[model samples]
Target chain A: MTTSKSNFSKPLILVTNDDGIDAKGINELIKMIDSLGEILVVAPDSPRSGQSSAISSGYPLRLIPVEKKEDFTSFKTNGTPVDCIKLALNFLCDRRPDLLVSGINHGSNAGVSVVYSGTMGAAIEGAIVGIPSAGFSLCSHNPDANFSACSDIVTFTCRKLLEQGLPQSVCLNINIPASDKINGVKVCRQAHGYWTEEYDRRTDPYGKDYFWLTGQFINLEPDNEETDEWALAHNYISVVPTTYDQSAIKYIDTTRNLFSE
Target chain B: MTTSKSNFSKPLILVTNDDGIDAKGINELIKMIDSLGEILVVAPDSPRSGQSSAISSGYPLRLIPVEKKEDFTSFKTNGTPVDCIKLALNFLCDRRPDLLVSGINHGSNAGVSVVYSGTMGAAIEGAIVGIPSAGFSLCSHNPDANFSACSDIVTFTCRKLLEQGLPQSVCLNINIPASDKINGVKVCRQAHGYWTEEYDRRTDPYGKDYFWLTGQFINLEPDNEETDEWALAHNYISVVPTTYDQSAIKYIDTTRNLFSE
Candidate 1:
């Protein structure tokens, strides 16, 4: 294993994804940004979708080295997305990473899906450690989905982030529409929406009932152009600056009043 | 199974927790609020800590009914805390819950831990469904922790929430100190903090290395009186109004300027 020694010459970039180290999305992302910096990849060994900020406890984690090259190294762990970030930051990285990027996820992490996204969870973990971080996703869930359309946008966004640091405690959730012809990018707010969960019930061989989780996204404000959902629907790449601190500051006083009596 | 028909005669309260169906903290929580409304519990069958807003998608889930009474019914699911909430709201509940409460957690879910809390995840799910919700946590992690001191506070908070509805998409994260005599209650903001992860590495009999996840919280703003950490340290019950919408709205303009070039 390479020692985590500081090399102040070039920027060290930490790359990861929730879709595991072998996914096409992450491979495309690594190739697109190879010129940006020295790369260190630590990701889950298998797809860990919908695991938002979940960390594995009560069990020991194993990190296996997958590949090693000059200026690039890769390892896969038997852990969740957030666990990958923790392992990379705390044990693996050669130094404090200059920038941390997660995903070119297999599906959309737009709207309220951010809360249930392992992609965003890794980025949020990076932000917590004071790293400039961002998560990227395509609207399509196809295993062999074309990510070429997202290459330039991803590179540009990362370049800008490297040039200009993001505010502390903030990370970006970038969702690109699944289109051959792209629209421009827009910085927008997280749209108010939810999954209308419909469980597909079936009986097992033992005559026991089981359910498969399925849902459709319901946009509460479909016409609001300021929302990420609206931006994505109009074929624009949506970027929402998200924070780990979820305090609703505007309602503090109201809550205080409710408790005072 | 009960039908999901609205019964507006009495308030229907949905109760849940991250620490399985049999944890002492949850039992204490359910007992304290029995008089407020009709209670229906849908929780995980086993302890599911640190599962923040995670949902199970690729696998089938099983919900097992454990107990049934006149005004209270309980079911345990083989899923994450957020999944339990989804199942209750969409499949199990006899009606829309007027109020939702998660935990009197064995450990504190204050400060940045809120982002990783399954307790808070369930409450956030409740808030997303427009129900008044709150998650309660004591500062202890002991399996048989004394919870008598938290009884009055839990009852009072639920009563107030039932009386005055929380704003849409907002929920409370109430963390009590371990002290038996609480100083009082303080409504505060989520504190700035991060866990300093220390992985305990060990060599297995097969000559492979593994790591156990462990950490200490490093509070960034230790002196900030407005933060949740400070409130908890002063022996007060910290009530932070948390929102699931994590957009950092103040950074939108700056982010837009970065992309404008």
Candidate 2:
């Protein structure tokens, strides 16, 4: 363990991920952003993919320190990605974090996938707390997926976020193509899409039936070039400004009319 | 068990909740909307609060048949609320459901709580699949909370949804006050708010420390009467048209500029 006085001038950065602290993706993210500022890594001890904004409750959460250095310290928790952000904000960090970055996730969190992504969940949680935040993901699911192509984009996005803060209640969802030669970057919206789920039903040795979840994403508008899905398909990094506010303002009046009738 | 031929004339309704199969809130919700259509319930076997759009993967999910009747049938699964919706859409329901309703949750899913609510997760999942959907919640966390006051609102809202479908990719988040006489209903937006978390730290007998999550919600705009928090505080049932598309459209251009520079 190494201890030193806090540097007051440098920014404090809180880093977290849904793929757990030991995952290659998160480690890659830390290495990419090491020069950004003072870093605090509080992440889940186990993989928590598909855990979107899920907070652990009805039980106590535990945190174990993994590493400590002069400007970088790390801890692992038996909590979800959102819980890690909450714990860091409320208990761990001595001062408010200047920036919060989550993931160089092993899988893409684009389009409708953000709703089921623990990587985006951490970033959303950070934005909800008024922190400039961003989540980065590669369009690959392999545990040993190479994140080398994402380093430049991740660093660029974080630098921009830190330089020019996002609007209130907004965060960035950045998805990179799994290619060494990235085409370019495109600012896009979440593509309107849904998963066409296929459950693999199987009978156990004891004759009990069970099902495993697997799905193919159905892009409602595949031809729309302004969506994250389209960007990723074209080998471009997609950067979608995301928010936690789910209110559909356009339908408020129509919904009121329906109730009135 | 009772089996009858499907009635094509009557709408097929799918009901689910974050609270487990036996929860009073869900049962009350089922009873309230029974007259609207034939119902199929696919819900978690155990409570899955705070699971927002979380899909269970890398493991097999088991479903147990609980009850069966001519017009009503239910199966409980070892999955999250969102998983229940996916299972219902992909595996359980024989035909496409005309409507999907979740909750009458034991607690409120208003303000910023929707991001953490398994009830809303089910509803959002239903909407993503193009089903007309809604989630109901009472502002009470009591397991045995009285839901008699929520009956009329629940029935009225469901009937309206069945009569006039919502816009694409939209769903309703209807939160009711726990009172015998409700003032009225208000169609409102989600209030901008954040929870001020307070972790109750304790040391176990094994000399390890743990934290229990507890928090108070702080409304960012307390005087805004157009928000759900204000409507709920005024004893009115708050109806927010919610969507799963979290893209911040207003910031897309600004973000593009940031990346370009």
Query: Interface Cα RMSD per model, in Å?
Result: 0.9, 1.0
Q: Label model 1 with its docking quality class.
A: high
DockQ for every prediction shown: 0.84, 0.84
Model 1 agreement with the true structure over A1-261: per-residue lDDT tens digits: 454435668788888999999899999999899899887889999999999999888589998988555457888999999999898887787678889999999999998899999999999998888899999999999999999888988899889888897999999999999998778898999999888856888899999988898879999999999999999999999999999999999999999999999
Q: Which digits, one per residue and each the tens of the lDDT, describe model 1 over residues B1-261? A: 564335567788898999898899998898899888888889999999899899998689998887555457888999999999888887778777889999979899999999999999999998888999999999999989998878988999898988889999899999989888789999999999899956887899999989998889999999999999999999999999999999999999988888999
- Residue range A1-261, candidate 2, lDDT tens digits: 122126768788899999899899988898888898888899999999999999988689998888645347898999999999998888778788889999989999999999999999999999999999999999999999999899888888778777888898999999999997789999999999988856788899999988998878999989899999999999999999999999999998888898787
- lDDT (Cα, tens digit) per residue for candidate 2, span B25-139: 9898988988888888988998999999998885889878886553588889999998888877776676788899999799899999999999999999988989999999999
Model 2, which residues run further than 4 Å from truth?
Answer: A1-5, A68-71, B1-5, B68-71
Clashing pairs in 1: none
In Å, residue A70's CA in model 2 sits off its true spot by 9.3
lDDT of 1 at A127: 86
